[model samples]
Target: MDDNNSFQTLTDYSLQVFQLCRLLWGPIETPKNVQLINQAYFEDQQRRHLLSNWLHQCILSQPQQEQWIMQNCEFLSRGLLNDCVKFAHDEGDLRLAALVHAASGSNTVRDILRHCAHEDIVDVYSKDFRRTIAILSGEFIVKGHNLVDQNRTTYWQMALALHLWFANSASDSVSTIVRDFESAYQEHYWLEPIAHHGNTKALDLRWKLLKLYTDDTYPIDNVFDVNSYTQNPFDYRL
Candidate 1:
């Protein structure tokens, strides 16, 4: 529980960074007088506001800070940034609900995720992710090549991590959940291409979010391939 750097409003960041955060954080809370054009958008804004408040309150501890950073790493690495944002927002809503309920001494998060629709449990990463859904639902005869390819590997990893994080028998550390599936930190052969594929603004914003959440030192070259803002290079080579 070291002191957090003073909270910086989204306005303090560059326009590109702010807009990217808007995508990650969802819409800001609209005024009560604002008429809702879309029910989904309204719900999103409300959830965003709630999660933001919850994070501001809960991110005071090292464990909580690590949890937030781990969540982002999983979400950011799983798919196209635009595709992942919606799922990330929904996951945050569920996490906020779970944490609130846990504080009140309830442990129903695991049951809710297990009994809900597959999509409710994790981001629809790809057809491969449908395999994860099947696995979670007790249909465990995995089909296809079962070979991890491209983002499919990350999809499986993130889905499992999310499940383990909120499960009734969940580990106390986010790193444990990662180790349960990933097992090691061997660099992927596709790292260079994956890094190159990421949008520069999105990558910068991801690093900014990571820094905001955790005080730990993660080499930027490893966390993000490069950002125009940093001019760092790919540091991980096979």
Candidate 2:
């Protein structure tokens, strides 16, 4: 098919899927409903495969446009799942972490934690460590680099430090932990850069989320580890 025809076909299919999602799962206001809608739409193996490829193409070729299309769609569950899966695999663990964070809620967090406590290598209650993962995930998403190109050394180091902080909370020496986190932020700034010229609004919103954690009182311990329980990594596309 020609580029125009392909685009048209994909657009039509995308719209159809969107409608089907609403019909099957109702309006997609919450993350649970989003997952339910996506699962229902992808019950057809053909759609599950085709939409996965289409969503990846949209993300790699025209991410901003893809985001626009997804936001405008009456149903976002499937599309969001597609986007998350595409980036999760193609973009690496960082993107997966971000998508998981975005999907979280009070109930989701508790459930994830219960599952993680039994299976994950790291302790779920380690607030500092969990918080670091969340922050790194957000940073990775905002930077928009290919997953392979991402410099995760600093992020990992911060995560380790946070884990130590949580593990040895009785010590009460948080200065080093704070410094480590700062170093991670600096590394993120230096390594993965984002253009804030045109998409100021989106950038602003991301910053707002980041700012919410700027204070010391933000409950880092509450950060949920979604990957801890599942044998496979979180792949929304599949």
Candidate 3:
């Protein structure tokens, strides 16, 4: 198939998925599970990544136009800003750090912390936007419905996934499909909440008595220990 045909096919399916995405994304219409929408977008991005590669496969030897793809891919690259900035600091690479900072989602508290040069927990809570601030900062604390909070899972899971994906560039594959997969993951990590559509997923209530972790499924255990969870968490292009 030609590039035009391939892009058409890709858009066609994206539009279909967009409908479902709108619903689970917890649009204001449902006004319930208002917090859990991020998890829904994360899962849907998984499907988008796979479909993206399939579209790419249809292009054959042609050089694909990346404008639309890049538009969607922005979510992934922006999501990595905190990790990228931290990576830059850890290695003391001034150039890399600057590049990461340039692309930061400025509204996020993490971006503010990255620029602030230190994590001031006191100032964070003192502010009216502490919850948004905390997740953006990637603080990873236990609060606000820990046991059954999909928002917490979404923020931390994407945080860990971003860190693990970019930690080792040497072993990361160079295939086109791999690129698409990573784009899917990175692009779905929106700093602001996705509003609109419809949803009602028990977001308001939390089970305080029972512990959330029956197993290691949703481990907020340690930021440093994420590497051991999977050799290659972003290797999902098959």
lDDT of 2 by residue, 1-238 (tens): 5769755644653454454333323432334444454543344333323323433433333324333232311112222434444444553655444534444323355345434433444334343333323332222222333121133422222232322322222233233333444454456632311211222212211122222233466543322322211122361221
Candidate 1 has its poorest 10 consecutive residues by lDDT at 188-197
Residue 55 lDDT (model 1): 31
| Runs off by more than 4 Å, candidate 2 | 1-184, 189-238
Top-lDDT candidate index:
1
> Candidate 3's residue-wise lDDT over 42-90, tens digit each?
5444543433333233223223235312221223323435655666567
Highest TM-score model number? 1
For each candidate, the alpha-carbon lDDT, in order, equals: 0.35, 0.33, 0.34
User: Which runs in model 3 stand beyond 4 Å of their true positions?
Assistant: 1-137, 140-196, 199-238
Query: Which window of 10 residues has the lowest lDDT sum in candidate 3?
Result: 202-211
**Residue 54 error, candidate 3, Å:** 12
> Alpha-carbon error at 54 in model 2, in Å?
23
Which is the better candidate, 1 or 2, if ranked by TM-score? 1
